[model samples]
Target: MSREEAVQRVAALIKGIKFCMLVTQTDQGRLHSRPVTTQEQDFDGDLWFIGGKDTEWVHDISQRPEINLAYAQPDGQNYVSITGRARLVEDRAKLEEVWSDFYKAYFPEGIDDPNVQLIHVDTHGAELWESSGKLASAFALAKGLVTGERGDMGSNETVSLE
Candidate 1:
């Protein structure tokens, strides 16, 4: 697929997914992953996430900027894996723009809370797997089983975001 089309497909697949697993490398070189709320915004090769300044993930990003984000929509059988470089940003304007009252649970002091921080991910590339639907997938699998061939599960592609 074309680069732009690939990006749009990814955006559509992850549209309503509220959270994704953010994976980072610890100081000891171990990979750690945690679920984080995805900021409500359009996907355009960059993603924004709100986090706490004192969080361990923040520290990991500071030490190792390379990170991975995994987004999944099991009901639709769509999954996206993104690799990128992340940095801690303190952009007040952006913080205010993406801020939501829901975050008060974590930053009780509001947007101005010192602990509130932004994680900016500049995506380098992504791998996406999307299925036609459950019924189609089942049929394909059944056909494959009978014919002794691999099932056409779905479209899988690796696209460069940069």
Candidate 2:
């Protein structure tokens, strides 16, 4: 798919998913993942997240900027995996723009909290899988078993955002 189309598709798939697993590489070269709140905003090859400057993930990102984000909506059978580079940002304006009241739970001092920080992810590529629905998927599997042929389970595509 075209780059623009690919980005849009990923955006649509991940829309309204309040949380995603942010995966980063630790100092030991092992992978670490944590659930983080995804800022409510339009996706445009860039993602914003709220985090703590003193967090382990933040330290990992400082050493290795490469990261991955996994978004899934099991009920809708849509999943997206995005590869990107991340960095800690101190953009006060952006922090305010994406700020939500729910974040007060983490940053009791509001956006002014000294530990509050922003993570900016510049995505380069994504892979997405979309299925029709639970019923359709079940039918496809049954058909495959009966006919001894591969059934059309869904559409899976990998696209470049860069």
Candidate 3:
């Protein structure tokens, strides 16, 4: 596919996946990853996430914004990786736009809570693979039978690195 097509496909995949691993850098320069719920992206490719202001990751991103995000299906046969830089946005209006019931479980007080913070991950680009995107399960199964690999699996990723 053309580069533009690939980029659009990647974004579509992102819209389909709700959870991702947000990777961030520690002070010692080591990488750390945590599961986070992804909300939406702005026109400039800025991804939105909600977290606590005093969280380790919030602090990490403050010092190191370079990051990556990953997503995949349950079967582990499909996955995507997104590279981005993150910055904190204090816009309550933006959070209001994306907040959902899932987030209510974490923040009963909602987006206006003093502890809540917004993370805007600036997506530079992404790469993806879906084992069943083409309905090629039978073919993949045959290949796996020969190669001794597993069946359809899914993964989605969003991360940060030093």
Which number leads on TM-score? Answer: 2
Q: Give the C-alpha miss distance for residue 19 in model 3, angstroms.
A: 0.9
TM values, all candidates: 0.95, 0.96, 0.75
Q: Which ranges of candidate 3 are over 4 A from the true structure?
A: 1-4, 40-44, 132-162
Error of 2 at 7 (Å): 1.4
Model 1: what TM-score?
0.95
Off by over 4 Å in 1: none
Comparison by TM-score, 1 against 3, better one: 1
Q: Could you give candidate 1's per-residue lDDT for residues 30-83 as a string of tens digits?
A: 999999999889898789999998999999999999999999999989999999
Report the CA-based lDDT of candidate 2 relative to the real structure: 0.93
Least lDDT summed over 10 consecutive residues: which range in candidate 2? 1-10
What C-alpha lDDT do the candidate models reach, one value each?
0.92, 0.93, 0.73
Give the TM-score ranking, best first: 2, 1, 3
lDDT of 3 by residue, 1-162 (tens): 454555566666666566889888999999999999877552235678888888999999999999878777655356778888899888878878877767767777876678888888767777666565445677767778998987663333333221
Q: What is the lDDT of residue 20 in candidate 1?
A: 97
- Per lDDT, the best of the predicted structures is 2
